[model samples]
Target: MADTQTMPVALVTGAGRGIGRSVASRLSAAGYRVALTARSVEDLAGTAAECPGETLVLPGDITDPAFVDQLYADIEAAWGAVSVLVANAGAGVSASVVRTTDEEWQRMLDLNLTAPFRCLRRALPAMVERRHGRVVVIASVAAKIGEPYISAYTASKHGVLGLVRSAAAEVATKGVTVNAVCPGYVDTPMTDATVRGIVEKTGRSEQEARSALASKQPIGRLITRDEVADAVLLCVTNGAITGQGINVDGGAVPS
Candidate 1:
């Protein structure tokens, strides 16, 4: 068994809650030294508390390039180059193509696409040089199939998946692996927010809104956070699974 000093280091963005929090805790329990970052200090602390292994809490906006750069530097200064990176920081905006404003479109792109791109770029050099790394971005089923009222979110997710595929190919010869975990509507706070939107727009009861989302999945239920984390773990352990978008969407989009 690897000692604490020799355990791999993992950095998880948007580690405050939802899938990010679950992934961070899962990595920690898997014997990784995790670094948690999000906009909320309290939430980061909450995630850190659940981690049985060592943890570093770094709270900041990943959409800011400066913050992304500094977090990598701080991680290196503390635990060394990141052996695993989960770019799970992202936001979804519900809007039609015509109704989507410039600000909303840009925000989706910045958080979902650009932020992951920046993190992937920063992590590659050290990983390639050391010839060891794993990168998994938490994307969505919207990336594969388009649905109504989410033009910006779908586009951004599509872009991130593309980024993952291209980056994985570039680092394939090296020991580093890059992949994306595309899940359907997960039972998370983010999904709760989406339900609220449905309530406001369609006058559907909160339960109805949630059930509608669940019905979209052929499994007739929402995907759990742990399920998504399992996919990330698969990517980390299997070196041959790079450049693929592993769907945890309960057979929603058959590939």
Candidate 2:
């Protein structure tokens, strides 16, 4: 159990669904007051309802700078200070480099790369002043291993890792640690959409399509949302883990 007296407040972006929702729920259960942010108010509310500690629902797009500023302000006013910031808002686009449009590429960078950087920039001042903080960015396996039809996503995640490494170095001596968790093919809404795409493209049943995708991993199954959440929890709770992109990929990439 987290110590209630020192129980820190956590702000998680993209907390409406998938790994984000799992992370928020786990943290709240561990006695952290959690602030949940996402674009869908209903989904955010549902996530908040599952949490044990005080939950603040702030629905907005993390890619929007103005909205992100407002989110921080709201959290600050209510929570007094943010001890953990989870940059978990990101999306994937299916397109090869040639087929990917400028808009698609920009959108991927905005969400997966720029959004995390912006949040870190805004959160760092307060964290530094307090001489303590934890920042965890939910990156992807594609960051290290390039995947076909996900060039934008791969590039964006790679950029995210770069940001993590740089930030970790900058704040290492200041009582803050920055790290990333790279998850492969988790059973989430994003994976559902990918399964649907495979079905549409190959005339396969949904189950078959999902199976094919899962088979790509050595474990022959998709990682669960809770599994990914466990990894994020490790990064946030462990003080010595910094500047590391811990892979939760079911041995998809042998290290």
Candidate 3:
């Protein structure tokens, strides 16, 4: 539980846009000093400008271990310790196993799995010492179900859930909670690209392509970025959400 007198600091990766941006903004509104990290300096700066409290833009490739170490070092030097870490920097690369190259497979695993692991490892020691921390990994619905042409993306997300579950169990008694949020078809740049891919394949209008994807979900439309952000906020602020993967997929996934 957070003390009312001491405002917590949150480090959000991929905070440039979409759900990550919304989560970072929401945390700031809730009185957390935010440290925004992304590969794009301009986009991170834009997000920082919208935040309510002190915001630091730390732009670097999260997949690079050296860059990750430097990121934590900078945070430790400036803020002493971070109270929250949102591992939201991930991407989807679609290709069947037979067509997937080793580079593609490794890239997905590096960004989606290993990067989060690195961030968690760096933050755990400080959080354990303080007896307070919230670690949220933003995974995807593909983790639970089979998605065609996206084997690497699915595998990486599944690995994310495994990491969250194992780490949460280890840190539960130490006042740190680790959790994963799985969102489906959120209206983001990622979805836009997916829609474009559909359009190219079917020669359909963008709206039609988007609709085709959205119709697969039980809900009639794609989930909004803010909706996903809300789920992350719940995980970060609640003490009892450890070792869980809360799905915000508009009921796309069955319980």
Candidate 4:
């Protein structure tokens, strides 16, 4: 674990909004000096303003390997080292397996799976050398269960889980722990997009579309962004917790 006395540096991808923004806020409140990253620096401003401690707003596309390298370089230059990494940036698409195009598959995989891989690849060496680090991947319930019309998203999320588990095993004895938080039907801009899609496709009211997603969970309501961030904080603070996919789906996949 990182030193509790000194403020740790937390790098959060997609810190622009939603769960990522919530995670950044939570970590900042917990005494972390957060480094926020997204496409445009302006996207991270809201999160940065909410942070209690220091913040670095980095703008870049993680799918580009060069950007991934440069992101770490800038963080290292500014904060020296990052003690925690929240791989939260992702993209989603709704399309049946037969209708999913190759471009869609690649885009989803590149941002959702490969980008996290790139971040971890850069992060592990420093963490391993220091013998202290926390890793949390913001995956989804889709990783554990299959849903129609989102084969690419499901596959990418599944890969995220695999990456978390395998990376945790590799660093198990090295003092770094990796874990994943799987959220179900989160109430966010992304959920709104899903709702809009449902409304367009099925001619359902927005409320009906929302309820359709909520009904999948046993709790019959959408999970909040902060709820998922809380789960990530559990892994971040507890050394005993590692290689686990903590679900915030209200029993939606029950994994």
Candidate 5:
């Protein structure tokens, strides 16, 4: 319902909930007109309520090429150019390498890797042409390190780093900075569902599985959504930094 097209515009995929919602809220509070896009309109509505400025609720399956095209077109038509793009829409599947089906692997890549690619493809041209833009991908710590049972998720997150580095290199000189925020275990509905899966599969108590997941981080707790959002805020707001994956993992994958 926001009609302010002249304000600086931001497009946040997966902006309905979780870290995406936090990013959108932060950006809106910082005076950008935010576009919230996710699969659920109702979820987007919740995020929209938190934004301080004008908000456009754009709901769709970002993995579809057609939807990506229209999303960019609509944003451009409405707001002139997309100033910030937070490619935060992704999903993870838990499976060992040998037990993982081709369908599972492909699904992970389609959403985590290729969907961002499509968004970037549509978003970058305007940024490149204008000589000003920010691209932030919500990657995972699985990108930098490996895990035992989630081969598909790990590989896809790794692929995200490749995309981030290559694109950042190409656009670094153009005033369009590209980077990623890699989180270890964030407290979100997604993580809750993951906890449920662990309980179901391993027959461990819910509390034990949750503890085990949090134990990966030296801080003995899951990362907060706002913690991840802070890194993204820097990536999009600061012009100098580029081609990096800032880990918000509480020393989980330290050097």
Candidate 6:
């Protein structure tokens, strides 16, 4: 058996809830000393409580470059350089290209694309030096295809997917692997918000709106948080799975 103190260290961003929380718990169960981060201290505390193994909770806004730098520094100070990074914190906004305000467009790019890029930049050098690391970005099916009223969100996800592919290629010679997990309409608070928006805009009942979203997946259900976490763990453990976006979308956007 391996020493608990020598367990691999994993840092999961946006870990307060949803897929991030599930990923953190899953990694902890897999014997990783997981570090959890998000903007909400209460939420991070809740996630840390659910983790079965050791956890370090750090709360902050990952979109801020300074915070991203400090986040990596703090994690390194606590548990050396992270051997696994799950960049799962992101937000989506629905608007037609014409209706999307500059602020909203930038928000999507900042939180979903640029923030992950910053985290990757900060984490990759140490990982390359160690020649042992895994990076999984929690992207969306939006990254793989175009959809109405979500142009900005799609653009951001697509950009992050490109980032993952490029980074994976750059570090393939090293022992590091970079991948993205693309989930579709996950049953999380984020999807709850999307359902609420549909109800408000289309006058659909809550159940009807939810079913409509679920029907988008051929499986007729929103993807589960645990399912997405499973994909992340696969990327973490499989050295040959680099530069791939494993879809947990129930066959929604088959590529």
- The weakest ten consecutive residues by lDDT in model 5 span 1-10
Q: Per-residue lDDT of 1-255 in model 1, one digit per residue for the tens? A: 566678899999999999999999999999999999999999999999999989999999999999999999999999988999999998899988999999999999999999999999999999999999999999998888899999999999999999999999899999999999999999999999999999999999999999999999999999999999999999999999999999999999985
- What TM-score should be assigned to candidate 1? 0.98
Candidate 2 achieves a global lDDT of: 0.91
RMSD of 3: 2.3
Best by lDDT: 1
RMSD, candidate 4, Å: 2.2
Against the reference, the lDDT scores of all candidates come to 0.94, 0.91, 0.91, 0.93, 0.92, 0.93
Q: Which ranges in model 6 have alpha carbons more than 4 Å from their true place?
A: 1-5
- Write down the lDDT that model 5 would get: 0.92
**For model 2, what is the alpha-carbon lDDT of residue 210?**
89
Cα deviation of 152 in candidate 1 (Å)? Answer: 0.4
The residue pairs in collision within model 2 are: none
Model 5 TM-score on a 0 to 1 scale: 0.97
Q: Which wins on TM-score, candidate 1 or candidate 4?
A: 1
Q: On residues 82-109, what C-alpha lDDT tens digit does candidate 6 reach at each position?
A: 9999999999888889999999999999
**lDDT score at residue 94, model 3, on the 0-100 scale:** 72
The reply for model 2, stretches above 4 Å from the true place, is 1-6
Candidate 5 shows a clash count of: 0
Residue pairs with colliding backbones in model 6 are none
Off by over 4 Å in 5: 1-6
Tens digit of per-residue lDDT, candidate 5, span 99-181: 99999999999999999998988889989998999999999999999979899999999999889999999999999999989
lDDT of 2 by residue, 1-255 (tens): 555457688999999999999999999998889999999999999999889888999888899999989989998888767889999988888977999999999999999999999999999888999999999999998878887899999999999999999999999999899999998899999999998888887899999998988987789899999999998899887889999998998999854
TM-score of each: 0.98, 0.96, 0.96, 0.97, 0.97, 0.98
Candidate 1 regions exceeding 4 Å error are none
lDDT (tens digit, per residue) of candidate 4 on 1-255: 556446678999999999999999999999898999998677699889998788999988989999999999998988878899999999799999999999999999999999999999899999999999999999999889998899999999999999999999999999999999999999998999999999999999999999999998899999999999999999999998899988899986766
